[model samples]
Target chain A: MSDSTKVRYLEGHKGPTVEIPTPEGVPLRFTVASGGDRAGAFLLDAFLIIMAVIVCGIVITALMVIDSATASSLAFVLIFGFRNFYFSGLEILWRGRTVGKRMIGLQVIDRSGKPLRVEAIFARNLTREIEVFLPLTILLAGDELIPNLPPWGRLISLLWVMGFIFFPLFNKQRLRVGDLVAGTMVVQAPRRTLLPDLVEEPAEEVASGEMARFAFTREQLDSYGIYELQVLEKILREPKTPAETLLAVSERIAKKIGYTGEMYPSLEFLSEFYRAQRAYLEGRMLMGDKRADKSVAPQAGKPRALQTKLSGKERSRAKPSASAEPLQWRTPEDPPQAASQAGDPAGPRVPPVPVVPPAPPTPPADEV
Target chain B: MSEIALKSTQFRQEREKRWRELERLVTQVEKRGIRSLTADELHDLPVLYRGVISSLSVARSISLDRNVLEYLEGLAVRSYFVVYSPRRRPGEVVIEYLTHSFPQAVRDLKVWVALSMAVTVVGFLAAYGMTLSNLDNYDLFVSPDYSAGRNPSSTREELRAVLMNEGEKVESQSLGVFATFLFTHNAQIGLLCYALGAVPLLLVGLLLIQNGLILGAFAALHEQKGLSVELWSWLLPHGVTELLAVMLCGGAGFAVGMAAIFPGRRTRLESMVVAGRRAGVIAIGCVGMFFIAALIEGFFRQLVNDLTIRYSVALITGLFWIYYFGWVGRKARPA
Candidate 1:
């Protein structure tokens, strides 16, 4: 059977990502960039190489007192070899961010979003002589290059240039000839996102009871990564976000987190869940306790009481409330840190099955 | 503010400052290299990294904004490489390639090397025999310009002078530069042959065979002129190394071409990709061979005129290369 990813690709997403799950259960997504970006970077790199070549040529002819004709020929070799070395060298040394790639906000990474290795760098740059540099060089300077070249030779060169240069446009990922050869990709480098300011929370210290409604076990919080958290935040911020969409997203998250309790308002559950999870995660970070990555979960029915008491890692399975306003969670009544602190990642964290009895409902709060 | 936006905005206001601070520090680390960081800055690196990672995870699961996600992703990746990946100096890389990667690649591509030899040998013998069999086909393969008056019609005396006069027609400094240009040009041709494999490989065959035909025709023409011995002696200083380099590239071309023609359960593109990787390595490793060949041809050939000494040099160099690919870097081979 065809891989589902290819099927989705054929169905047509302009650029699809290869998802590599990190230790945190967040898939570091690498999205393939457009061919135009590759060309842009190449042109920039080529310009730099050519300038260096000119300097070398002048040095050889003037300082070294070499004949101009010989210097030009020597310069040509330097120009060619240096182009290959520059890219392969810089990328491997810097783990795939070249000067041009850095400038264009593009990077070369393994399909799995792993850092690049020297082998791939060599593969791509070596093949580039034919796929990119050769064809481009011929197309641009054919007339003067081999003055008496045969018509067939010229035709082959032209066809060669066109074939490799345009190959990326035809592919779904806009991958160039070298990219195909090396099994590498060019992607837009991710940047820091500036989020809109959130409304200030109540001045009261985080209330243990309010946090109880959104209290998530470390595993529950670990289900989604920072990427997912921002995604949830974006949805929460949308003015016209539909109810069905919210329901669907929250339900999926709830299932993943193993929450099997009564369904609360999806928005309320998510926002309250977001606040609690954020607090829990940040607290762990502050304490230098490693967030339990998805791979290492509390084994079935296994909870360490001593370590849980010491680290105060959140071990509570989710307690989804039946409220409409998750805002009640932001009250600063000294956020129920003690309860979460009492819970450890290795404490009670069975989402599909609750380890503790249901708690009494909190008193209703005034609507914001 | 809407509850979620308020929550998100508050979250951002509380943590964005630290995230930006960490971003600046990380950017500084990246730009100036890790060594440039102060001791205090270095101590704070991981703490800040953890902060960003936590922030990224929280923002990702809660925030709906793609801008924040993108920012976190970029920072996370940069920091990930920074914390985990080893930094390599350019000199280290060059040394690594020369000592380990190149030899290992050459060994791995032994199949292509053998195939290239086969094609070249077949072409050499055929062209060598063709001139012996019939003089009429002489012009078909060997162009007169390249012949440098060493064709069948040339006298033995004229052919013998080619040994001394060949390649020296140019001045010394220009000769080295000219040779370097030829090496680059030939390297381009070798890679071109490999890339042409994507065109269903018809040209790949033509290229390999053309190289063979030229060698064979040249050998045959020299034999006809009764100057074959002198030609062999003259070519020995560089021909063995040059021929091996070209042959390896020819094998690379064939490997790429055959992968396209017969995909062996993979999609044609996938097969080509695999072959392209191998071919890429072969092409890269042998690039220096062209330079070595140019040096031998330009300086050594002119210096070492005696046939026996030239032959010994060829044999020693040939054995050295064989030993290199066979034994060197075997311990450090990548899994």
Candidate 2:
């Protein structure tokens, strides 16, 4: 499992990449944020903090007029401490987001694909003291403090400041000194849409019995998992993907999953394979078991909205409760739910109908 | 067997509903924060998340389609980040960090701290030896521009006067200004030491040596002129904190650099990250040390000319720090 992770990086891909695995062992997909976006977030955060500093400065100045001696030092500590404190505080509380990160649609996450942790946040922001804030402080503030300072001090401070500011540009991930240390990455929040399935309808394009061109045994269907299924799906939907590549992928997958049938066109095989896999997965789901988990008896108690509404609408729950579908009986034609009910001598556990017969030869797609 | 498979359209018909729902909820959470979701939507999120995960699981089990799998994977992750991550406040975070994270990190880098001390000590010893071996070696380490007033040529009485801030008019204002200057100078070196750790090949060791050399050369001059008593009093008032701060910063740098040079079992990046966290914390925390050191050097050092008083103050501060850092929050019950 870990071996594939090491070689996950491919050529031409920029930005920081993280691989998260589901229980099924396939990696989750996410797009890491670009540097410009992060910079924008940083600018927003910097702006907010600067406003705070200004407010603090005003308060300090007022205190100075009232009681000048300690106020100045108090002001310095406030400014110094707040700059370091702000991001770490916000990111940790906000779950790897500051006001700027939230506003800019950026989030920090563990590079290992775990939820963001506090140590990472602390490590990263602490580095910001030297990397982003302190250098600027030294270069600008130090210049004013000691007027007769030697030339070397000023030059060194300036160089140090520039190096930190530009460090992100040199790396694809745009990690600062802090991020590099924490093994955390600032990424855009995940927002990928499921593209419309392009597999042709039986009545629309596929010829009579063409869907059945590549038939497989139940054992063969059970042999492969969702990760493999997605690969096939990607090949079929991606028209731009080459024919040879599709053939190569499907052929290799067929061999690996123990599909013992006469070869059909790659698209037909994929369509058939997709359909069978879908049925099996849906059946399993009805039993209330996850992909890899042991099957449990389906609950007799239907949850709110699922029984009455279209599973899709209930799935999204997009409409407010006021307008949502209130009650609707299960349709006999509902392939998956109907199948779950078919062989339920006891619990409405899914896929049992298909599994009971083991090799109920040539069960129709609708009746499986 | 052939009849068992559904048409491509029917295959999607069975599952697209759940996939689409998850996609929308994920989108909503992404656009607005997760808390923006309605109660039902909130309840539906994990349910749908589990469903989608199951779908991916089944999809893989049957060797299902990629687009569907990709969509579910994306949706699962989106919801995971939102629903799973616990909200926290900045105050809580700061408290946790100060009470545990910062100190734990500091303690972890004790070896690096020692290494940094070694560099400073070696530098001090080498410079002291060179200057004491021959008066000419004084020119090798100490520059006239930086020496303020004391030098190898200065007589014993002059060195003693200068070491105790007795040479000039000893006005408080100039001394304060000079102390502030020294504080900034030390801090700049500290920052440099830590930053240069990014590339272990250069700067980390050199800067510490440079620091130690200057200290050694100055101390050697005073010692040779029979002004060690004056030198000890002058340094003790604030130098204890000031030097510790400098050495701590150097240690932080060495910690970061050592990660790069010797990553141990972890990858280079991983090791650097582990080291960078503790070292960077030490470096940032050391800033306060500098500020405190400056406060004492600027105000208190010049006012009190009594050597015993200065030494006692230094002793109390040193002991206080040892207690505070070593045991202050170790067994605390606060969150």
Candidate 1: stretches off by over 4 Å: A1-15, A46-70, A136-160, A193-368, B1-5, B9-25, B37-51, B166-171, B197-200, B259-274, B332-335
Model 2, range B10-39, lDDT digits (tens) per residue?
545687787788778877765666667786
In candidate 2, how many Å is residue A275 off?
A: 19
Q: Report the lDDT tens digits of candidate 1 across residue range B25-71.
A: 87786778777878777666666666666666666544434456677
- In model 2, the runs with Cα more than 4 Å from the true position are A1-17, A22-27, A46-65, A126-172, A190-368, B1-104, B129-192, B224-227, B284-306, B316-335
lDDT of each model, Cα atoms only? 0.64, 0.64
Cα lDDT tens digits, model 2, A161-266, are: 7887788888867778778877887777643456766444434434454444555544444444333344455556665766666576566657655666766677
CAPRI band of model 1? incorrect
Interface RMSD of 2: 12.0
RMSD of 2: 15.2
